[model samples]
Target: MSPSETPEVVLHDLRAGDGLPLVLVHGFPLDHRMWDEVARFLPDGLAVVAPDAPGFGDALLTESEPSIEGIADAVAEALAARGVERAVVAGMSMGGYVALALAERHPGLVAALGLVDTKSVADAPEARDNRLRIADEAERTGSVAPVRGMREALLGETSRATRPDLVAEVGAWIEEQRPEAVAWAQRAMASRPDRTAVLAAYGGPVSVVVGVEDELTPIEQAEHLVESSHDASEAALVLVPDAGHLAAVEEPEHVAGALARLHARVTR
Candidate 1:
């Protein structure tokens, strides 16, 4: 996509505070509402901007190719629209792909990074093929039912066993997504490149967060991220006990605290 063809991004701006802006990018097949729980616990004097990635939420992707780079460009444009020169970028799951893309494509715009329940490596061949299959199913059915099987995989054993209400809430969010959007997001994630180099090159404060019980993008992924950074000593890794893939929702207070610490470190 060319500069002229870039689509306008939909932003959920809570411009209620000061300090450096914190931009939150939600995961695939989900909207900015994914950050609702975590956002409430953020420290005062920090501006928060959560944007809907293209083809997800109310945002539409104008580009024919639904690449993660395209989503990153949209995020950069969204920040520009808000007059934000630089900000800490936090992303969960597929949102992590877009965050890494943003850091790689628009390095100057990212002041810091908060990666939650995500990995720096690209999808394996089998994973890519599976994603394509899921996308195809979604397109064929005109429904997100194809991916609903992942609901249990997205949460921890504890969450599944104890917090049925939270699990149901997450399922509801997943069910509300548009099939086309889900397909587009799957394709984008499938095509993403290994972004460990981006972390190795980034100089800002980095926060690597993951749920201890997360079946997908587990603790090892978070550790790898911290270890791969330019200065491993500077990176902060936080593990949320009994949480799963959706760490932000499962343990909002912990996620928010990690973010707040990262923000403080960056500002200091």
Candidate 2:
């Protein structure tokens, strides 16, 4: 009953009565705090574990060059140590990449899947180069200033206009991240391969949620995820209205409801 042997508290664990644990992975340059609000609205007795991927949060910052595979492995080991043999895995943005990798690497570890505001394709040539450039800057300056303006791209038009406080809040979250974490994430993301095949191969119940106004990974990206799934018709799709890439943070209640529904499908 005690996780005394678990390596360390990764980020947040609301381990209520559990059948299958719900593992939430956060996006890049940010930590597990991004999922806190949405985690609150999930159904009762649903165990939730939100872990900061490797270098991003309270995790042990390593000198290892980050890779999605490394992040995926870290998540699996952490969960296994906590007695979670399998889980309903969900992630947003960079976290989604990690989730897809997790399912790919761990095979039977994922019982269901949730992808939010993320794409299955690798970065285009230009995008990959830009990420490396930012990584270099972050590592050199030892700061997140290189990616400081990401709030504009991460939030949707409506949220950006109406929620200045939200904008600032997200920015603050970015600023708190360690520069090494930021650099590690950028390089890891830049090196990720196209994972649409991961979706195509996965047979578990799948749900894809996105902010309606998400410009970075727009609705088209969400649609691609659903369509790429093994059974497209069964995949649940939830688009958070008036939100953007960080939909779960911008509109936690709605995203939480979407996750709750996904959980029902898995648990039922």
Candidate 3:
């Protein structure tokens, strides 16, 4: 795909043996490729759908405002277009926000939810300020350098040295992204709503996963989600050792394991 070429929306459907649908959502500044690693071990006989968020990857952003709701709507549209009715939606970071929005906006569409390395609360003032600051930097610097910093921020501190291959894979993916898309996503995520209430209100099987070394969305936030989730009894928390924000990439096997277990729980 060329740098300027923007597809309406990129949807990748990987057919496993086929049972229930597992929809994977990517985080900000990234596309569906982030799930490639973990998708390998997600078990057979389950359909895996990884859609690139609008304004990211092959998915183009034709909309004026790309808020969480907008992204969720676009995803729902894409799923509908592809004949997906009910799915086990799993999201990471920015994708997590979209997942919650999806569950809220179209409850019937989600059979189960997996929130990974993301928070249920809205962006705090300080967090919003940071996103805005990054957006300003992206606007000024054309989004590449700032996004590079974002890559570092998302990965664990030790990943740079211990997991060079993972870092390289994510770095290449970041470099492949369009600058305009990154900036737009930065703005959208900055303005996203608080979804703590969404979690508390939604009565569904939810799986919350976090990385031990994830500084961005710390364990405390995961704990809060565990406490607040409506189906707390069914809410499963998997803390991956030596992993960080991007758990799927940092420890793909572990993330996949958690996802497989969640899938089984919801299906059974």
Candidate 4:
């Protein structure tokens, strides 16, 4: 892809709030709605834009290969469309991959970062193969059931044992995803490069958040993100207790608090 090429994706611009803009990127098989609860807890006077990444939610995948870099470019374009020059980019899970890509590919657009329930490493061989298999199944079946099967791994043990309602809500979101989107996202993630170097080089504030009970991208990954960043002393490492991969959804207040702090640090 050329530097001038950016995929066209839909942007949900919430024109409320006052300070610097906050761009929220959702994970695979989910849409901007994933941040609904977290958005409510954000500090007032901030502009928030949540976009549907290509091949996910309402966004269409126009690229031949939906690579993470391509999605990151799309995010930059979406932000530009909203008249936002630069903003704090926050992402979860697969979205985090795109956020890292944004910092690497479009550094001017990212003032800070909020990486939640995500990691900076590329998928291992076994994990890559597994993602391909899941993608293949989704393409063949035209259904997201295979991806949905990962709910247990995506949620924390505590959420699974106690928050049946939240689990069901998450399931509904997964079920609504288009199978093609699931396949494309799997492929995109499988092909993503290790972006720890991006964090190591970033000069702005970063918030690495994880759920204490998260099994997918565990607490260790969050700690590594903070430790590896070039500005480690400025990065904030937050652990949301009893939450899982969808920490923002499970513990919106805690996630919001982390984001608020990051915003405060950046603006100050």
The most accurate candidate by TM-score is 1
Model 3 per-residue lDDT tens digits across residues 111-150:
8889999997888799788877877777787756777866
Winner on lDDT (2 vs 3) = 2
Tens-digit per-residue lDDT, 149-207, candidate 4: 66667788899999889889889999988898888888889999999999999888899
For model 1, where is the 10-residue window of minimal lDDT? 1-10
Candidate 3 residue pairs in backbone clash: 17-45, 18-45
Give, for candidate 3, the lowest lDDT window spanning 10 residues: 1-10
- Candidate 3's TM-score: 0.93
In model 4, what is the error at residue 16, expressed in angstroms? 1.4
Model 2 lDDT, residue 133, Cα: 95
Q: lDDT value for candidate 2?
A: 0.86
Native-vs-model 4 lDDT? 0.86
Off by over 4 Å in 4: 1-6
Order of quality (lDDT): 1, 2, 4, 3
lDDT of 2 by residue, 83-186 (tens): 88889999999989989998899978999899999989999999999999998999999889999989788999998899999999899988888887777788
Model 1, 1-268: lDDT tens per residue? Answer: 6634655468887556876899999986788998988889998777888998776777875655768887889889877877887889999988888888888999999989989999999989999999999999999999999889767888898899999998898889889888988888888889999999999998888999999999989899999999999889888889999899988988999999999898888788
Q: How accurate is candidate 1 locally (lDDT)?
A: 0.87
Whole-model Cα lDDT of every candidate shown, in order = 0.87, 0.86, 0.83, 0.86
